[model samples]
Structure formats: structure tokens, C-alpha cells
Target: MSVRQTRKYTHKFHAPTTLKTDSIFYRIFQSLPSTFFELINQPASLAQAYQFSSVEVKQLAFRIDGVFLPNTSELPIYFAEVQFQPDKKFYSRLFAEIFNYLDKTELINNWGGVVIFPNRSVDTGATERYTELLNSPRVTRIYLDELTAIAASSIGIEAVKLIIEPESTATTKAIEIVNSARQQIIDAAQQREIIQLIETILIYKLPRLSREEMGKMFGLNELKQTRFYQEVFAEGKLEGKLEGKEEGKLETIPQLLALGLSIQQIAQALGLDEQVVRQAAQPKL
Candidate 1:
């Protein structure tokens, strides 16, 4: 019997803390700190005076995904966390970590926090104890579903919203962001970075797609040349088990379809003819 192992997110101090979406959020904040402020209804100009960095609370059970440190002592430090999984103690634990970090640093600045959730539902509602803090402006909880609430004029903000877009329309939105990023971002290197960021988001959202297909979809000749895309493609190995029996491959048609893969793509990945994949997609008589 084959045992299926499920990867569960944990709060331990030393586990594999790299989440699928964590790095994407981290990059967006570091490259575009202005977008981080915009997410919390702050003026984009505030970013000009702050530098962002990820913090690790030494020997602690938690980590701050990102922190915005002000150049001057006048502004408070803001920490950011991307929480997709539901952990009832998330907020409490975050507070502990933030305090721990503050204790270590000699800088005497006030601090605030931001947590990004997919929506209101994913956030555990065990906040009765911290009602004052929760209601205060210091803690900003962002619900990604309500994209309209965000004044998404900047390309960075646009990329952040694109991460949570519905699958049916995500491709169209990704393409639009790519075009916008290319046209808006002046530097060639920055343009490629933003475009690659968008591509990375789509890859995480739609893992079933192969690199070739993704390149064609984005219409970028340099996409496949990017190191991130190559690494992700190798890890996913959509065409793994090339030697498996035809019947086994046939059984995967429905699963692939459910993952938003087209019949042609499925057949190509499985090394089977399109006709056979099409036939497998039909209802069994």
C-alpha cells in the first residue's frame, strides 16, 4: 500500500518555512516597498523613507516575513506576514515574535503589523482578548478577495492583486500585468523582474502547466531563460513517470482537467496522442 503524505504548515522554529507564496510576497515587498504601504491604505510616498527586510527572531518559534524600517526615528516600524493556512494562534504568536525582535534591536521606534489573508474566512476569529489592538489602526489585516478596495494604480499593487485572481480570469489578468509592467517600468532589468514575478505567480497558481506552454501564453522569449522558471519546472516534472503504463496515464486525464489543463496539454505531458486523451475525457459508457 502506498501512503500519501500531506504537507502541513507548522509553527515550529526550524522547519521548512519557505511557503509557495511566501517568497512571492517577500520579493514584491522588497522590490516595491511602496506597494506594501498602499496595501494598508498608507501613502505610497511613505515608502521612500523606509527600507524593507525579512527578520528572523533568534531561537524563537516564529519569523517575521518582512519588516519596513524607517530611515528616521519619527516613523514606526511595520512588519508584514503572509498567512494562507488557518492557525488559531497566528496573531498571538506573531505578537510574541515581534516583541522578541524589538527587544533585540537597540532602535527605539514604535511598531505596527500587517497580515495578509486570502479572505476573512481563513483568519481565525479568536481575537476576543486583543479587541483593542485588533480594532486599532496599528494592525492591518488585508483580505485579498476584495481587490477593488485597494487603489491598485501602481504595477506592484497590480501584481499583488493578480496573485489571488480567480483561475478562469487569472491568465488574462497576468497578460495584462505583463503588458503594463513592460510599458510602465522604464528600466530593462526591472521590467524583466516584474514580468518574471507575474509569471512566477501564475506558475504557483497553475502548477499543472509546463514551461513551454507558459512561455507561449506569456509571449515572452526570455521567460524560459529565467532561472526561477527552470528550477520550478524541474521540481514539478509534469511529465514524470514517462515509462508508466498507458492505462495509468489515461487515469490521470480527469485529474489534469480538474487542475485546469487542456486536453492537448495533458496528452503532450503524458506522451499520449491527443485522440486518446480526448477519448479518456468523455463519460464512460
Candidate 2:
């Protein structure tokens, strides 16, 4: 993936704790930069114009990571900062790093910055020295909790919102998000990434829940692709088992029964009447 160069996705938000919320946001940036652009009130298509990566300011003894560098020099480079905990020096350090990188780098592109906090309250960085920069278009500040007016549409944005969702409703919301991802995203790999990302977020949100329990909440989309499921579905016509004959179909009913499908489900799947499925399900003498 070319980092931030992806499509636009919009959705409303509402929402975690320690266990490194910043890293979760980092994962979001890696997997779905569209959500970041949406958070900044930019078109999701804009992500396609930028590449995201980290920059090392060797002289400064630090690295300025999480940057969105436009493909063309005409567009400004965006510095992204995710702040999960309150830091009094956050803005000072942010500006310092940005200016330092700008000074050393040959790229003369204009620069902007965005600071993302879990909520407004956690954004306690002292802005006195950099008030002008902080208040201008050069910088965009996002409080995830305050995001509103977005359509309930983009699965990408919805996944971002999962970070702050309350523990009580997180699982239910996760399931909904997983289903939406499966339905809306056509690309198989992207769909799996979204599903895994959602599951990762839930694992963080509800740490008490077991992985097995969490796996039950979301079908990973690989089941239907397996040979076992292929035979079980059998085109819902008892396909491939006992081919082209009623006896073959009847014979497979025992296999389906052994596989734990109920009589009605097997009947519906095989296009057989319930009584016939029941008779086939009976122990052979």
C-alpha cells in the first residue's frame, strides 16, 4: 500500500484506555489513511496524492515520523501527531520537530500539521508560544470524541471510532462494523485487513474478553473458501457429493447430519423435503 493514497470514506464517530492508544492510531494510519483525511475534513481522494512515512532528523537526535508527503511538490507535506495522553510540551515538541525537518530536508513543499487527541480534555499541551501556528490553517487539530456530522457510511472511519467506544457496547459495535466491512469492501485483502483491524481494536477495548469469544463475534470471511464449507454448501443442491443421482444426494445427508447440520437446514440446503432429509438422517440398518 502507498500509505495514505487511498479512497475517501465518511462516517459519524463516538467512542479506551492505556495499552497504547497512540499505537492503535498508528495502526489506523498504516491501514486506513482515508480515515485520517476524513478526520481533517479533507476529501478522501486527497489521500491518493500523498505518501506517508517517517523521517529521521539525525542531527536533532530524533525522528519525525507520521508524515504525509504529497506525490507532487505542489501540495504541502502534512505532519501527523497522535496524542493519547496529556502532555504539557506536546505542541512545543511537535512544532520543533516539524520545523527541524523542514529546515534540513531539500523538499521545499509548504507544510501543515495535525494533532489528534482521543478527546478535547487530553489535549492539554501549552500553546502559548505557538499560538499563531496552532490557530491557523497550517495546523488542524482533531479530537476523536468530538467528530460529528459525518454520514454513517465509511467503514474506515467507523473503524477509527471503535477506539473510544465504551466497553459496554464495543462488542456489538465491533460486530456491526465487521459486517459493514464485509459487505462494502469488495477487495478480499482489504476486507481482511479491515476485519483484522476491527478485531484488534476490540481486543484492546475489551481486554477482559477472550480471543475465542471475539472470533465468534466476527466471521473472518475465509470459511466459505474452505473445501469443507464448499462441500457443505454443495451449491445448496448437494453438489459434488453423490453426483446426478437421488441416492447420492440421500447418502450425503448422513454426512451432513454428522457434520452437525439440523434436519431442516440440510433439507433446505439439499432442496429435499424435510421428511426425506429425516429419513436419510435415520441410522441405516
Best by TM-score: 2
Estimated TM-score for each candidate: 0.70, 0.72
| lDDT for each residue of candidate 1 in 1-285, tens digit (9 for 90 to 100) | 000123234321111232366678878887777888888888999999998875555555444557888999989999887777687877776676677889887889998988888778878857877889889988999888886765446888788888778777878888888888767878877777887788777766776655555645543234534544456546644345344788778876775565446777778778899999999999888
lDDT of 2: 0.70
Q: What is the per-residue lDDT of model 2 for residues 1-285, given as tens digits with 9 covering 90 to 100?
A: 111113311211222334455556667777777777888888988988987778776765666558888989899998887777677877776777788788999998998888877788878989899888877899998877776567654777777777887788888888898788777778988777777677667655666765335435644234334334454465656556545567777878776555445677667666789999888788868
For each candidate, what is the lDDT?
A: 0.71, 0.70
lDDT of 2 at 61: 63
Runs with alpha carbons beyond 4 Å of true place in candidate 1: 1-19, 59-63, 219-221, 227-285
